[model samples]
Target: MLGSLLIANRGEIARRIIRTCRRLGIRTVAVYSEADAQAPFVREADQAVAIGPAPASESYLVGAKILEAALQSGAQAIHPGYGFLSENADFAEAVTAAGLIWVGPPPSSIRAMGLKDAAKKLMAEAGVPVTPGYMGDDQSEATLLAEAERIGFPVLIKAVAGGGGKGMRKVDAAKDFAAALTSCRREAKASFGDDHVLLETYATRPRHIEVQVFADSHGNAVHLYERDCSLQRRHQKVIEEAPAPGMTDEVREAVCQAAVRAALAVGYVGAGTIEFIADTTDGLKADRIWFMEMNTRLQVEHPVTEAITSQDLVEWQLRVASGEPLPLTQAEIPRRGHAIEARLYAENPHTGFLPSIGRLDHFRTPSDIRLDSAVEEGGVVTPFYDPMISKLIVHGPTRQAAAAKLAAACRAVEVYPVKTNAGFLARCLADPDFLSGAVDTGFIGERLASLLPPAEPSERVLQAAANEMVRRAGVPPALTGFRVNADPSFRVPLDHEGTRYTAQISPGAQPSALHVVVSGRDFIVFEDGEPYVLTLPRVEAGPEGSDGDGGVESSMPGLIIEVMVAVGDTVSKGAPLLVLEAMKMEHTLTAPFDGVVASLSVKKGDRVAEHVLLVKLDPSEVK
Candidate 1:
């Protein structure tokens, strides 16, 4: 085994590789950009090197700088964790030429599957079921339009290179095909440097199920069942599970075998994935699953596979890269219980799930299950990289148990300041269709209403607060002596979500009775309502930092992509104030609201940070 290795990537996956390297007695060298100097992944490595600026093109994607770092560190091997140049064929070849082991599939295999259109054609030749679509090389608009019409009405235009829902578009009718193709081609060219696209018939109800396959230099490969990545938003997976929820025994076997065949087709070695789109309406079948794509590196949801198989995939990658024979036969890989994973991101769900950045004031993770992360409480969630905070994974003997555990684990964990998708994830796991195992790729949008719990308080909660506050502070209590007076009325103050809720207190019951109503909720005062409601929402902590987490001024740095407000706009709390597009993702700024703009510091197309003043407002208007 190699004693030292260089990780040519950043973020959580890079940290994950370092962890496995440590366990295997391999020293790790981490490469980071200028903005990532203080990143958690950079600090966790045995040795670190500065590559370039914050932009990935000048930093992580700089193959020459990466090679220089590896050679300088005297590393014997390089591991490209999942993204950036992980699937770059030339990078793999360059590492080998430098006398360093490339801890991934061979360069030849990456070349074969790098392009979606070509890969589909190859799969068809290998007898692996592929989606019926146009895999031809003709890029003329006329030819493409003709193919789309012949294939069907609804189709998908996917980039030949790149993944992660980037450079992909869905066309529902011929009328929209031309515009979608243009947009898709532009994004593809920008994201992957290749505008080549392939059209595929859109599945009526698509379920993204992929099989994990491991192979060794000795040409031995085995399959590791499959994972269901059906639940997603904006083409990004939100939840994933192993031993797909509604798969049958026969179909599972056929799908697994097909994946094994696809892997072996290219003499594939190390950990790889063969993604398939399944039609569950008629149940699983050998003919029901179609080859979608292949991920040429360790997947983000690998922990789910590890939980079920009790095997370390990272170790397997190292072993395979060492030219060793398969460690275990196909029979040795057992299908155990169910496992599920949810990606927790530092983003907001209230407004189109825009990425949010801030200090993790109270970062807490659950210990009942496995958790993989690279950030900590004091770590800055900079817009220089992916906003994903961590991945929460859980295992249980049954699917129901796994769902239950995932829901509880998500809710039990707490993160302050930067809003996260944890609440959204918890709601998804507890969803009825998900629990019943009747899910599909369109689940998130199909059931958006019931799944999203309205951000409104219950009447009982308001009543309880009013009763408690009035009894606790007698300064604003009803003037009528409770025991002696027949009737009485009083007004009291309450606060909620940065808004004030004035309560009206009414005397009821025989003697010495108290009843209060706030926001149409009734509350009865017991023991003068002292203990129940200390202060009704307590809104007037004016001009003070009331952020739930430790008040950090700026969480990340990015360009002010757009500014929606100027001084003097009476916006509500939670309204979009502006947007910061960084790291290929958009982070939105929200108004503290109920205040007029006092000043403006930054405008659209300017650079800003967590502490930077884009806009200022008066705190008094909030009252």
Candidate 2:
């Protein structure tokens, strides 16, 4: 076994690797950027080193810095925990050249499967069924447009080097193809530094299924099982589960065998995942499944595979890198009950999933399940990294039981100041179609409104907040009016999201288990994983405070990537004004109402902080 290891990534994944290392008696060294200096993973490691500034380009993505950290800390192996440089073949080679073990697939495997277009061609050559698409070398716009037409109207434009739903777009009509292609290319260039893309036919009822395969230097490979990651938003996975709900024995064999073949074809070692796009319109048949791409490193959803197989994948990676043989044969690997994982992100579901950054103030998750978290109660969620704060994994005897347990766990999540998608996740698990195993990639988009929590606090939630407020004010719950004939309740004025409500606090009223947290003059009431931040109404504020002043402010700290409108531009409601890249995602700010752009303060490439006014709009006079 490797004596010591260096983790080259941050957040929950770093903590996850450290956990298995600790169990195996391996000393762990953590390399962090300035932004993550005080992160939970840094404090949990056996040793730590600061690499560079907060920007990933200057820190985590810099191979030389990471190599130096490992050398300085005397780490025998470097574990690229999934994201930054995990799949960078050059980085892997650099690590090996420095006489340090790279705890991942061989550099050759990464390079072979790094680009989607090339990987698909390679998979097809290896006799593995691949999705029908154009992976040709024609780079001109005319060729791409012609290819899209030939592939059919509904086609997917995917970046050759894309993953995690970035640099991908689906166009349904020929008229919208050009604009979509331009946007896709721009994003692809910004994300992967490569604007090359491939066209693929978009499945009407697509299901994302991936097989978890592991290999060793002894030329042995085996698959743990498969995971269904169909519950997605913006092409990114929202929930994942092991042993897909409708997978059959025969189909499982076919897919799993194909995955192993793909691994062996590239001489892959260590852990990797072969992602497939399945046409579920005809069920999970063998012929309907097609290879999409290969992830040459550990995946974010690997825990579900670990739970179902009763295997420590990180341990397996470590062993393989240490020149060990496969621990179990294909048939020897145990497969058990179902498991589900929900990614808890620090974002507001009410605001179209905008990333929310702030101090955690109060962070509490259920204790019974396995939780891999990045931030704790007092930790801050900076905008420099991914918004995912934790992942909640639950295992049960059956799929239904597992989904139920996961849903309950999501509802049990209690966070404050910073918003999260816990409530949205719980609702997704409880959705009738989801529970019935009828989900597709478009499930969330089809039922988004119903899945979101209520925009306003319910009557019960308001009452609970009022009760907590009264209790905190040192007033007894059973207190009655001083007048003989006076009513037994007093009105408490509360403001929630700029709306005022007068809650009649009845004396002796029983308080509900709404999980209320008191913060100064505000009471944050959590119900079903949705937080309702309520504050005591200010006596001097007026109704106008709720109205918008036509000033467009940055919701979070980010770099301006594009400005679509000028100062004199007349735009209607929902017209895109500019694009802000933050937290590894691009957000387009749109006009809130029909207005004329009166002022423009920021330009492309300008880095702005949260709440900085970027544009000012005036109501259109002609309207």
Candidate 3:
């Protein structure tokens, strides 16, 4: 076994690797950027090194700095935990060249599967079933358009080097293909530095099914079953589970065997995943499942696999890298129970899932289940990297039980200041379609309205707030003058998101069981995993602007990518004004109403902070 290892990543995954290393008696070294200097992972490691500034380009992505850090810390191996340089073939080769063990697949395997276009060709030649698509080398727009037309409508435009749902778009018709292609290529170039793309036929009911495969230097490979990651939003997975709900033994055998073959074909070693897009129109059939791409490193959703298989994957990776044979054969690996994992992100579901960045003034998750968190209470969620705050994993005797437990765990979450998707995840887990196992990639989009938390607080929540308020005021039950004909109650005027409501509080009423946190004058009540902020009415004056003011402000800190309108430009309501890139996603700000652009304050390539005014407009007088 490797004596010492360096984790070339940060956040939960880094901490996760450190945990396994500690159990195995392997000394661990952590490398962090300025932004993560005080992060939990850095403090937990036996040795630490500062790489560079906050931006990934200057820190995490700099391979030279990481290699130097490894040399300085005397780390014998480098483990690139999932993202950053995890799949960078050059980085893997560099680690080996420096005489340090690379705890990942061989560079050759990474290169073979790095690009979607080339990987598809290799899979097809190896007799592995692949999705129908165009992977040709013609870079002309005309050629892409022709391919889209030939393949029919509802085609998917995917970047050659894309992962994590970046650089991907789904076009439903011919008229939208060109614009979609342009957006896809631009994002691809920004994300992967490769604007090349390929086309695939979008399935009617797509389910993302992936099998975890491991290989050793002794030319032995085995499979660890499969996981279902179909519950997605904008092509990104929201929930994942092991032993897919509808998977049969026969189908599971077929997929797992195919995954092992793919690993052997690439001379793969260490942990990797083979993602397949399954058409579930008639249930999970081996024939309907086709290879999408290969992830050459550990996945973000590996916890679900670990929960069911009763194995530590990071230990396997280290053992294989240390020249050991497979720890367990395919038949020996056990699959015991159902497991589910939900990614808790620092983003607001009410605001189109825009990434939220701020201090975690109050943070608490259920203690019964496993939680891999990136930030702690009082820690700041900077806008420099992925917004995932933590991952909640639960295991149970059955899928239904696991889902029920996970839903309750989500509802028990109490986070304030920084918004999260806890409520959204709870709703998704409890939805009827999800509970019935009739889910697809488009499930969230189809039932979004029902899943979103209600705009206004319920009567129960208001009563809880009022009760808490009364308790805080130190008012006793006897203080309320005894009434002869009615229950003694007092009205409490409260404001919630600009709306005022009067809650009648009775000193003798039953105290609410709902969890409530007090932040100064604001009362944050958690109901069904949603946080409702209620405060006493203020006597301050209101802002002097109306909707007609047409002032546009940045929703979050981001870089301006495109400005579609200019000063004096006439635009209608909902017209795209500019594009802002934040948290690795693009958001287009639109006009609130029909108006003429009165002023512009930002340009392309300019970085702006949250709530900074970027544009102003004058309402159209003719209207």
Q: Pick the candidate with the highest lDDT.
A: 3
Give Cα distance to truth, residue 558, candidate 2, Å.
Answer: 47
Q: Could you give me the TM-score of model 2 versus the true structure?
A: 0.85
The CA lDDT of each predicted structure is 0.78, 0.88, 0.89
Candidate 1 C-alpha lDDT tens digits along 195-293: 999999898888899999998988789988899999988789999999898788888889999999999898898999999998766766678789999
- Scored by Cα lDDT, where does model 3 land? 0.89
lDDT of 3 by residue, 112-165 (tens): 999999988888888889988899999798999899899988899999999879
lDDT, candidate 2, 60-156, per-residue tens: 9999999999999999999998889999999999999999999998889999999999999999989899988899999788998899899997999
TM-score to native of every candidate shown? 0.77, 0.85, 0.85
Model 1 steric clash total: 8
lDDT of 1 at 438: 85
Residue 191 of candidate 3: its Cα lDDT? 84
